[model samples]
Target chain A: MMHSLLVEGFGVQNWTYVLVGITFTLYIGIAIWARAGSTKEFYVAGGGVSPLANGMATAADWMSAASFISMAGIISFDGYDGAVYLMGWTGGYVLLALLLAPYLRKFGKFTVPDFIGDRYYSNTARLVGVICALIVSFTYVAGQMRGVGLVFSRFLEVDINTGVIIGMIIVLFYAVLGGMKGITYTQVAQYCVLIFAFMVPAIFISIQMTGNPIPQLGFGSQLADGSGTYLLDKLDGLSTDLGFNEYTEGSKSTIDIFAITLALMVGTAGLPHVIVRFFTVKRVRDARKSAGIALLLIVILYTTAPAVAVFARTNMIETVSNKPYANVPEWFKKWETTELIKFTDKNNDGLIQYVADESKNELFVDKDIMVLANPEIAKLPDWIIALVAAGALAAALSTAAGLLLVISASVSHDLIKKMINPKISEKGELIAARLSAVVAVCIAGYFGINPPGFVAATVALAFGLAAASFFPAIILGIFYKKMNKEGAIAGMVIGILLMLFYMTKFKFGWFGGGTKADWWFGISPEGFGTVAMIINFVVSIVIMKFTPETPKDVQEIVEKIRIPSGAGAATH
Target chain B: MSEKSNAKAYWKENIRYVLILLAIWFMVSFAAGILFKDELNTIRIGGFKLGFWFAQQGSMYVFVILIFVYVRLMNKLDKKYGYDA
Candidate 1:
């Protein structure tokens, strides 16, 4: 178990140990420094986090390991079709800012279920919200934990299960100790480390590719190798030459791309961890302001992703194409041992001839390795490689901590305090939240050891599920006064069940077997959430007509949440 | 204007701004990025096809601008309605 695995005969194990050790130590130190005493402080950081600080925390929480480690790899492989992620993840913030964040802030709640329960005047609505939150957040946290495991296994030479347990223990210490207060402050530090770590190597690669320091401009500038060709134009040509789709043109059907993008956007808006960040700020106005700032911070990394993808893709082609298998670079050899990048001489030519056709193509590379291996692929220094590892860990840990907090809050604050035992004291609720955090972390760690799907795919499913379940309920609750509790509860159940059915049928083929050819209107399972959301909306509207209106006080509360006026301190 | 009327007027203005901003949002992401991408791809901007730019990079820029526009418009409306924090 303690055997040393050499990466290129260099002790990456030592570098990873030092860097990860320092970051984990620093994070725990911050958690101890920022420990919360009261439930209010623990849940929403006493509702006094500055807009800028809160924005940074929100960005860190929102951008998970999928964004840091796998997104560039996805874009590299999917080409223009990958734009769905870029547009979907960022565009959802607009919905959050305009439709949800401000009103939720005015409601001044500890958790998203608090709003659902109070707004609908039904414990059923609250419990439904709590369940959806747990499903989405736990699914999300499991993916992040897997990301943590991946970084440790590759960098520290530890097994993936050990990495997951280590990540869980560190997350439990901070999450149980500081709660949201600790998580928020720690995330701000994480944001600084992650963005800087993400950008330095990107800048280096961009300059090496196009002679431009800015990755964004470098993506469009002429190749620095004196090819006199634009970077994307070169990439598109290389891609098409290999039978891959043009780098800038959509390959998937138009409707599928549209549906997937819509689902991710709506799901992002409905996410509990992201929504809870809005509650930490003091006022409705600050909530709006914080969302804009978060987007600004997130867009910096997001916009860089495509450029990095292009750089990684172009470099990969030049390095591997027409080269003998024996001459493959050290990085290529290293990755192959992990089986993330595979090569077989189908033609027995002893040369690496990569093509889009799987039958003839000998080189197969997993998309997730592209970002993590970018430094090595470019022959960058070891320190930069170590920094990338640290950054990936930070991104994964920050998101996992935030998600565990939400899962704990939904269980403790919403389910236990609100329903199971209404007379639970403040101290008792705090203990329950901490206890739930420990249990949720253990569950998430288990999932990390046995992840269901690819990191980005599982994360996408989390978003899709959230969109299908929570987005409609919360939106209708705020905007439509006549939507009764019965309608809301029924809509959630119908929406989530439809999504689960489609996903299991298509993605897993759980009940008998279903395939893409049998897809309804040719919509894939990833995009099915969009259709399910429409069903939720339609079902809610139709059911509202047949049911009685919401109570008068509930209508008054809805009106009160809309106006920014009378927003006082959040009650414990 | 009375407080209730002022609040009503402010709410109307807020809705108007949200509508206009949402229109821009819809155009950039759904329309230009998806429906009109092929048409716009005929024209290249810098190294990116116009449509490709909108899909990967351009739409995100527009979204950020849209949010700030909402913030600015809502802040003014809040001040008008005496709801500014």
Candidate 2:
């Protein structure tokens, strides 16, 4: 059962052990220090976390397994066009901090539902928020668990399914025991490891290729080989020569990409798991500070990704081109066999041009594999590979735990307790939350076993859903004074169901495998979510205008949320 | 009421920045991807066409830098309004 890589001198066993030891110890340390007590502690760390610490945790939370592993891989293949995720993800934080974070913090809530419920004065609005939160969190978490399985399988030498089951157990243990307080502290540690792991490879690779240790600048700078062309430029040239769109241009319609980017940007601002992080800070000022810090940390990774993409592409292309397929390195052959890196051997020359030949060029490699495969491609030592394994696992496990807690919260906090049993006790609700986390993990593990094509695509679907469903409600609830209960709930339901229908119909042919011709308004599922977002906003505004005025007390609430006045020392 | 005028000025200033920033966002992604793509194709800044690079790399770097710029500007504005924490 030993994989060939394990057989080859990479003692993945030792490396994996080191990785697990460090992660387990870190999680344990965080749990003991940031112990939870009241339900508030479980929900939002009792609003006492420092801006820097919250920022660190937020960075880790925001940069999931896909960002760590697949971003560069995607960028390498996607070229400059792939910058949407990088830009959208990072830029969205600015919108979040300026427009959303401070007000949400001042609202002083446990979850997004808590904010929506209190704001609209309706159980229905709370329930709708809960449903949207659950959908977005679950869809995102499933991918994270799958990422854990992949990393564990590679490093621990276990079957993927076993790796997933083990991951589920570890995530469940910490999440149930510590809740937000425990997860936040653990995530701080995860941020350090994931960023260091990401940068080390980039740094090492940059030094080798560009003779520069600073990866951010070096990637766009000229290659060390003195070819006069920057690594990025060379890559675009090489790729386009083979008939691919220049790495920086669009092969798809511009409108679609524009729409998708907007959706992702808004979606990031509105994500329940992400927004709820603001509640963990002590005050509105702390929330804004935390947002700034989070943006700072995220930019480091986000900026470096484009460089990593160019560097990785240049290096990968150079390795495969013009070489005899047999004489290629062992990893090349291994990847080829797995169909991760396929060559058509055009002209039967026994060499892969790896050019972007539109018709005949079949130099197809799963873009997600690029980041995971980097250490091996560079022929770095085995420990780096093991370190990567650990990094990917941390990225996956940390985010998965966060998402599952949110899902379980939606069910226990917003739906069952509020609607079905308003009389539910704190203890009973707590127990229900724990049980829900376990069930949710099991379901996520199932999807991990059968991950849908490309992690990025799945994540995009999650973002689109959030943009369509929760974003309008949250943004409107904060900015508009007149938004009412019925309007908010209806907007959420219509937006969510419409987005889901569009996603399923286009992505899976939900209603009898509809063809492309069946697409509504030529909008792909990816773009449809943005359109749905507009509908929600317009509908909410128009309905609020027509409806009777909000309760007189509602103005007081908005006034309270805006003022950074002396609320006295924040009591946890 | 005078304070309200001050707050209104602050709001207008913020709006101006947003409008300018939005233009950059559009030019990088939408304009580069659609309208100006062919124009960018003529200029090879290294190995990539300018338009393609904008879509993938240029816009991202600008976004990161913009966050810091906004932060700096907002901090100054906050101090002006006595809102600095």
In order, the Cα lDDT scores of the candidates are 0.90, 0.77
How close is every model to the real structure, measured as TM-score?
0.97, 0.90
DockQ each: 0.82, 0.35
Candidate with top lDDT is 1
lDDT of 1 by residue, B19-75 (tens): 889889999999999989999999987898999999999999999999998999889
Estimate the Cα RMSD of every predicted model relative to the unseen true structure.
Answer: 2.7, 3.7
Show where candidate 2 strays beyond 4 Å: A1-13, A333-363, A512-522, A566-572, B1-58, B61-85
Residues A1-572, model 2: lDDT tens digits:
46775577647568778887888778877777776675667777777889899999998988898898888788777765576687677667767876788778877777888788889998778877887888888788878877787666655657778888988888877888888888999999999888888888888988998888988768756888877767766766787776777666646566666677787888898888899888888766677778878877877887778778877777777887777776777667655654567767767888766665556664778887788788788887777877877788778878887788788777777776777887888788877777887888888888888887567788878988998888888877876767887778778888988898888877877867576577666656766778999998887777777787789798568755665434332221
List, in order, the clash count of every candidate structure. 0, 8
**Which model scores highest in DockQ?**
1
Residues B8-74, model 2: lDDT tens digits: 5765676687667667766765677446777887887644567765655566666655655666676
Which residue segments of model 1 deviate by more than 4 Å?
Answer: A1-11
> Could you tell me the fnat of model 1?
0.80
